[model samples]
Target chain A: MTSSTTLRQESVRETRAPVEVRGLHRAYGARQVIRGLDLRVQAGEFLCLLGPSGCGKTTLLRTLAGLDAADAGEVDVPTQVAIVFQEPRLLPWKRVDFNVRFGVAGTRGARAQALAALEEVGLADHADAWPGTLSGGQAQRVALARALVREPHLLLLDEPFAALDALTRIRMQALVRELVDRHRPATVLVTHDVEEAILLGDRVLVMAEGRIVRDSDTTGITRDAADAVALDVLRRDLLRELGVGG
Target chain B: MPFLLLLAWQLLASGGAIDERLFSSPAHTAHALWMLTTNGTLASNVLVSLRRSAIGLLLGVSTAVALATVSGLWRLGEELVDSTIQMVRTVPVFALTSVFVVWFGLGELSKELLIAMACFFPVYLNVHGGIRNVDRRLVEMAVAMGKGRRQIIRHVVLPGAMPQTLVGLRYSLSISVLALVVAETLNTTSGLGYLMANAQQYLDTDVIFACVVVYCLMGITADLVVRVLEWRTLAWRTGVGNR
Candidate 1:
């Protein structure tokens, strides 16, 4: 029994990185969307992908989430994965709790589990409310809760906070950071906002024309906006990579 | 406003400005309605007509929903079925009465089939359009969550198409009633149309008007039933006075 337990622990540790990709290519008819990309996300690491609108960030995210197939090359992801898109994408016909319960099995205590998820998002009082009736921030929170309830090995976020106002976006970013730390998923967040990438990521990758051009580690940098020197230097470097004037 | 219109109609008929033989006053029509009710003809005819409409609507709407679902979910099904429906819809269904009578021998089958034909197209067209118009992003989200095809259809596609399907039901219900009126005119031994046709031999315009009133009531009542159903099933929808 002791030997078996040791073996299981070793296997679990070996599978720490939930995503691995090499030479991944995707295209739409004549136009290529993602071309010859390679990435790996270690367990409990938060990696942010910063890119312009047509720079294949969303395409890469979709391929990672298994929502789209790659045209060529090898891509491996864990079986359990969740994604939160820019839109909340809740079913308008379902109540808040039911939408959260969507991916959950209908076995015993499913409702309780759903309610617990809602509680984590500060929406315990709105479990029975229609999704259409909730404010945009609350709706996005429910979406986050929906993704988190699955306890996924990997979590993919496609600019989820883009539609939110600045104040709400900050709060949601905090919530995501807190949740990712607690749940310990290998997370990949695709965003156009360089500051968001800096604040939320352990590592940031800047992409241009469907290829990663720069990779930076922010492990020693403080995320606080008041840390003007470090934040400014990081922002200037990212802007230079993106070919944007600082 | 209705009462004022009735008063005006009555005054004009009694004053001889309009020929009473040609156009019955509201009072005359009310008298005819009372006589039909007292003699139990209205009750029996209404029951017969209701039964026919119910059975025909059941057949038509169920078949339409089934076909729409099949076509909406699969490209092959759409390619196989949609063009035929479009072609058949272009031909007026009401004008098929003679062909139906010749095929079915003027029995209740002919009338019921006519009603079903009238109800089928609008329901199928709207439901097909609705299912096709469901947001692709939502479908992708469901797929990402590992939802199976059947689960996605049941949970996402059907409910997404519901609002438009209800609109189709409202339209088809009115069309069904209109088709019923036309079908009941053909060798109907026991319906409002038969009663009106029998009275026409005697030039009884009042009974004709009474039948018109019953048809109006049926249309209004069907619309109200659909409205109530929409209110109950689409409770999550907020716009259009739901708030």
Candidate 2:
């Protein structure tokens, strides 16, 4: 038992700086979005960020995803990083499989890999369908497939399930948890839902005004072995940090 | 409904409710068309006109694409080129026929130039707008996925701007035909315009009616050609008017 525990810790330990961000400062013209922020995620860790709207969680995520350059920061991440925005953002002109195949490594087996990714997302049947034809949830599933197709070392999810309905949102949450475990990418999911943060993240960080206000270690209470009391305490803490009534 | 219109016209013509000297009967117009065809007048005139229209369309589309690329992609080009085009495009190009004749003389060159100028605005304006209005989200998505500059251009920018560019092509097509009529009126010796001109000199109402039919068919053919191109190129589009 001790040996197995050691092995598991080693597996999730920091390998080679999958996502190491420090002093990330971002500003949109005159208004500052993300102040000097520091963050890190381990090799197989899932980190959820909880914050109020316009609290710079997305700005931090975009900086880490390399979509926007950090004004002043130390951002060390692997080149194979995949990010899903709040919207599906699929190319309306391309089919589902082509969207998955986009920018995946190795052109030789890209088609087969795209198919496998789509199958994992339960969208294999929509390979040839246009992005415009799919329902909202289905289009987002295709987006998830596109993110996983790269087999990335760092995965960033910026409220990917926020647009979904209640049922679809819960379903996607489970699927994402399972896929993140399997792929084992250092993941950071920025979301407003406190329940989602506690359910999926091994560690949760609450942000306010472009900096982390509370960081909670939730490794002791994963979804599978979730203690109701512990989960409630963490949820209350996050909600309070986000300036909402617990 | 079109068949009924022709039937009504034929009834009015035979009953003398419509003057045959003014409005030629459909049967007489068809007979005149047959005479023009059999005598090779229609064939020769149509070939000359087809050559002119093709050249003008090609030149106009090429020039518009070149200008649109420059103006659409660069702020500097937009300031320099787009403003000048905006200034020039509003002057009703048909009214420029006399100016064109004086500049290039009443020759094939002037007719083709006028048609080319008429076609320039629709393609230029629409394609420039298309390039400007390409979904910024897609470009950001591509960049987030680590796609480089060339790949973003190839995958996102070009294909994203295509639907509106094709719309520009359709506008250019209809305008080209309209410009051809105005252009061919400038003193050239060959084309449907020339046929109508000769018929008008002798009051050949049947032949003039035949020429009108030919122009209508050409307009329909232009629209059909654009429809077919859109069907092939924009096969992924599945909204209103697609079916």
Candidate 3:
């Protein structure tokens, strides 16, 4: 079993390619959300876009997912891309299995693939449940499973666990880490939580006023201990930038 | 409170607090009901009215849904039909009844047509509004997931709009019943409206009251049916029963 799992992991690691973005600019009306932001994610890297509220982290993620058009700059992305929004955004009319399979080609194999994704998220038993019945954490997990099922070249997340309770958020962070390790998709997660960013991301990019302010690596540090260090640094830097504290 | 008022009305009539000739007692109306049932006239008239109303409601709902969907989804189609419908809907049901009677004659056809016309606007507007107001975020999610237009409509638009559509359907059903009664009163040979009209001509207040009672019962029955349908269709909606 160990040998087979190792082979599977190696095969997954081989499939991904680095994603590159250059001078990305997004504006909504008169408000400029992202101003000429440049970023890159190496193949199989977990990158987090960490920022304060209204800092355009979500806008960046949406642009990457191809859901929102960038006002300026070019983003060269792989065709295989999936996104998990902050809200579960699951179809209420569809059962859990159908919601996960939604956007996938409609076939028997697609249903099987959805089931496998649910199992990976530890939600195989909820395959027949409705989206409305799910707790916030469960729903977010389902959304994650939905993104994972696509086997995306780039998995973009827009604060997918922001609504969960503290305990559930920690569990979900760990679950995401495990899933990323297994799937090895080059991922970009936008978040307001500094600790979450440090815990889940191989590389963290801090944004302020729609531009990258800091970039750092937290490869070996676990999220729990790394939280305090990352939060203290990020708070001081963000406060200084906002002119809240000198 | 309504029940107590009704009871007071019964007491006032029984005690001759009001003239019996002008307002027949509830007991007299109940007796009239028995008489109509015994003669089978009430049942027959009710069946005719119900049949016409049901057929007209079915036709109106289906046509409105089809038209509203087409217009809602397609810009050109909406522009083509929107002004026409808005203009037609402004003309009262009574005004159209005469025209329908002229075209289809004073038969079931004319009455059914009038009811269908009466039922159309409420449903059309509700369905159109529902489709138009669907959350753009959900649509964005579906599109990002690679859903085609048809799939989005079926899986996203339809489900999201169902609650509003059902609301429109319930309103339309009540209007259809009202239109059927009014059309029958205007130019129908058979129906509860005919019975009431005939009773009124002879000043048989009891039979008139009985017919009115039947109309109320039918309206209540139609509402109950719609509620059942709403419950079935919107099983996924939270706090549905409370609403």
Each model's lDDT comes to 0.87, 0.85, 0.83
Tens-digit per-residue lDDT, A7-49, candidate 3:
0111233446577677777778889998888888988899988
Candidate 2 global CA lDDT score? 0.85
iRMS values in order, in angstroms? 2.1, 2.4, 3.0
- lDDT at residue A44 of model 1 (Cα atoms): 84
Report the error of model 1 at residue A17, Å: 3.7
Best by DockQ: 1
Count of clashes, each model: 0, 0, 0
All models, DockQ values? 0.55, 0.44, 0.36
How close is candidate 1 at the interface, in terms of C-alpha RMSD after superposing the true interface residues?
2.1
Q: Give the fraction of true interface contacts kept by model 1.
A: 0.71
- In candidate 1 the C-alpha lDDT for residue B120 amounts to 92
- The lowest-lDDT stretch of 10 consecutive residues in candidate 1 chain A is A1-10
Tens-digit lDDT track for model 2 on B18-91? 99999999999999999999999999998888788888988898899889978988899999999999999889
Q: B1-243, model 3: which lDDT tens digit per residue?
A: 988988998999999897877787888999999999999998999999999998898888889999999888889979998778988888787777778888998778888888888888889989988998888888999888878899899989988888899899889988887897788887667889999999989888888999889998988888898899888888777532333
Candidate 1 lDDT over B67-186, as tens digits, reads: 998898899999888888888889998788999999988778888888998999889999999999999889988998889888899889999999999999999899889988999988
lDDT of 2 by residue, A134-167 (tens): 8889989999999999888888999999999999
What is residue B218's positional error in candidate 1, in angstroms?
0.6
Q: DockQ score for model 3, please?
A: 0.36
In model 3 chain B, the worst 10-residue window by lDDT is B234-243
Taking chain A of model 3 alone, its TM-score versus the true chain A equals: 0.85
**Worst lDDT 10-window in candidate 2 chain A:** A1-10
Best first by DockQ, ranked:
1, 2, 3
